[model samples]
Target: VGSAAVVFQAARLESVPDRVSTLPEVEIQLFRDAVVQVQEEMKEIKERMADVLPAEERALFDAYVMMLESETLIDATIQRIRDGNWAPGALRHTIEENARVFEQMEDPYLRERASDIRDLGERILARLQSSEQRRTGWPQRTILVGEEISATQLAEVPREALAGVVSATGTGSSHVAILARAMGIPTVMGVTDLPVERMEGREVIVDGYQGRIYLQPSERVREEYLRLYEEEQALSASLREHAAEPAVTPDGHAVPVLVNGGLIADLKPSYVEGADGVGLYRTEIPFMIRDRFPAEEEQYQLYRQVLEAFAPRPVTLRTLDVGGDKPLPYFRFEEDNPFLGWRGIRITLDHPEIFLTQIRAMLRASEGLDNLHILLPMVSSLNEVEESCRLIEQAWQELCDEGRRLVYPQVGVMIEVPAAVYLVPALARRVDFLSVGTNDLVQYLLAVDRNNAHVADLYDSFHPAVLQALAQIADGAHHAGKPVSICGELAAVPEAAILLLGLGFDSLSVSVAALPRLKQVIRGFPLERSRALASEVMQSESSAEIRDRLRQALIEQGLGGLIRAGLH
Candidate 1:
């Protein structure tokens, strides 16, 4: 279902050289007009960001606005244009001068700001280029293919026009990837060694889930894909028929199926009714889309809306999980291994103010509501949990002191690191609940980087050791009388969901796209059969053996379509 084939253009930014030449008054006026136009657009962009982005992130555009209004930068551009240079060239020269000066700075943060300056410069240059020659035509059913699609470039792509996107290099953590997902566009990144320049505007099939791009298809292949797509549509229709129904099995086991993402509407029109509530409210959405950390009030408004939308139903909000793959423009760090570096609770702990701001906003959002739940991401130590607890208390107290109505919402830790899995028994006792982020947990447990396409085959969630760890974590949490749910992508796989159910996970959270299939699988097998399957899977020695066993069992149980349909 996560696949689409379309005739698309190999879109690439055409580099324009701002030349050193004389410009007349008319040209200078045009440059002024471009600047004013861009400034007006930036204002609209900022307002749009406020609704979707956190305050600090919305502040990103502030710098761009300031740069546009900066008398120094603006004067330099004007002087260069008046001194006989193309307006675009004059702007670029000023951008390069500022970049050069910033690059020479001694302070690391100041040096990093050079990147922002460069980014703004590019935006301005792009505007200048567009003023010269505006694009009025986009081919039908286009898929944007490029080495990388910047945030600025992505915004220019008409949302209603682009069918999908294929990138030669990008990770799931990249901002482009996040934007693509938010736009509901099918995208496959890290596609290597394709002659895209020559194949611009060619028919291709993009399988996002499989990470395959079929360049040119014969009639046979095209027909096959068409058949698969139609089959997918029919199956999706059948699954959505029971959207409002609870995830209950033949034996009357009702397991709450929750959807994970930043927005509640992300699940609407299909699986929203089926979903219980937010399992992993990735708080980083605002951060990822913006240039800086969100402000306290800006963060609060966003949090309050989400809480109000799903009031009374539990909504787990994951605090800032930044660093590494998800880097902020304002906060830059050098890490040998970023995933293990200053991230998640580490970032919050290190920056207490940032942590407190988020906590205060979260608590205040719960003003008269009890559905707000705070989850600390990438927590691996008791000290981190204790420190977070202290901050949470301090923030809650501070808000109460301010005469703000608030509640001490439930606090939880995400079990993504192996250390967390081992510490679950202790962590469960400290936190109200636990969630296994299998995407990171599997890689951490297996010592594999799923981002490395070369060894992606090694990133198996079905590994016996991984399965054992899940079982242990689930058991420990339940033993401590704390509920545990899985919010990782793995939890959405029908086969994996079946195994998780068998593994004793109290609940499971997945994307809306996978909700129906997951529910179907849950309803297909009774609790006893799932538990039995889980027991057998845990006993298996290897992933291959486990897969074979599960396939046979699913077929024998008349649920083979779950595997054949690729939901497994």
Candidate 2:
């Protein structure tokens, strides 16, 4: 394979400039004809791919085709213009403005979609102007560099056959990275702007563990990589031995290890790791992927599959936390700061039908399951909790009236909001459990935007304010005789795990990949020692000071390496 590493400072937008700057009468007529042609071609293509691709992939392709339908865009634009949503000459301007905002967003998914909008806008103008069509070709043996790839083109490459992916964008937690891991493909995205196309037909190597991409490696480099790969394989194989064992401390205290997952497909790894349960089930995925809300039957089918996949293992199914940063294209909403906008439980509450429908589906699907728990996200007030419970009750009554046997899952409220933390004593009394959503809790408490890379360092879970909130919530839950869990990324941190155990968390849920290291952390320190360390940590003035103190304590206890590797 050919490989090169020339940094792309900025993407060179290629299109026929001024092609649609002035639209004529003849051009508008041609645009309408083009729309008809594109629609016909799309219909024929879908029919041909019916048997070749899976239903999900087929649906994705259809959605892509729908996006390119000139009639749909024209109609949508016309409707908006008629409704006076945009002033005269603002349609293209609106799309361009939003596109730039998306480009600047930290999330790779949004950033890539921003570029997609730009492409879409041009196509709309082309349809309006009757511009000459451009031919598209394949980039075989070429490592395509972009922030993200089209969802329709996601499965184009055979998993093992593909060399590697080096995206100009993508976070470790993004869907693209998750898919790459599942496919067992070596991927190192977020590589600034490496010239991916030049790597075509060039011999190269990808080291995902070290996030490195070697271009035209010499014999020595190849040999070293082979040796390291073998070593890694051996190390991974060794982990299977402990897969069946309960994760316990040296003194024999059992710490339940669970996996965080969204799809039922993740259940295989959860079972293989001997996971106690699913810590977090992102229930918003199905809704976000679809063009519109799924039918009640369709929702039940998917939920039923997940309930059956884990069987007896507890699955904490969080309600749809859509809107804000994660807006569904099907639903239109405007907001200044999406992060602080209407989201999570608020969306569900406002749209009671949506909430009731999902609850009914989950309840019906969980007919024989005792481990299903419904978790509410972004809850801040007691009223929201009360209303959510009322909705659950209403759904239960409806299910009963219909003579459908259903098991109403336990309701848990995430204590992420500052107000929720303050009222945990009262909220704990109403809910079955309390799960501290530290990712948001820390972000909200410090008023720091987690997505802002420039201020990411300030977003620390170990902050004194964050710890104090955690302590309060956990203590309140304990007092109320309800279980408390930390489903946030902080629970995965080695040092943070010690504090969590000390602060009275019933369970510490983390990413599946972090389990082994967390297990090591558990074995290295006693519960009592961790409690003492926690007490000292809580008294520290600043998060930095607390981190330093924790490091010193870990080093004193001969766990510097573990802390450094997993925590820092």
Off by over 4 Å in 1: 1-142, 149-163, 170-187, 264-271, 564-568
Q: lDDT: which candidate is best?
A: 1
Per-residue error (Å), model 2, residue 460:
2.3
Expressed as tens digits, the lDDT of each residue in 1-568 for candidate 2 is 2232211211222211111213343444454554555556657767899989878766754654666654445555444444443211223544566578878999997788776666555544444333442212333433433444422233445333454556655543334554454444556666655554344345667776566777788899888877766655564455545656777766667877776666555666535356778778878777866789988899889888877777788888899887654667698699888778889998889999999999988888888776789999999899999999999999999888999776667899998889998898899889899888787778789987664534645767788888988999888899899999998878877778888888878787766666665666777778887788888788888888887776677677677655432322
Model 1 lowest lDDT segment of ten: 4-13
- Deviating ranges (above 4 Å) for candidate 2: 1-121, 124-145, 148-233, 269-273, 542-568
Report model 1's TM-score to 2 decimal places. 0.75
In Å, residue 81's CA in model 1 sits off its true spot by: 22
Name every residue pair that clashes in candidate 2.
Answer: 1-201, 1-202, 1-203, 2-199, 2-201, 2-202, 3-199
* C-alpha lDDT values of all predictions: 0.76, 0.67
Question: Residue 37 CA error for candidate 1 (Å)?
Answer: 20
Clashes of each: 6, 7
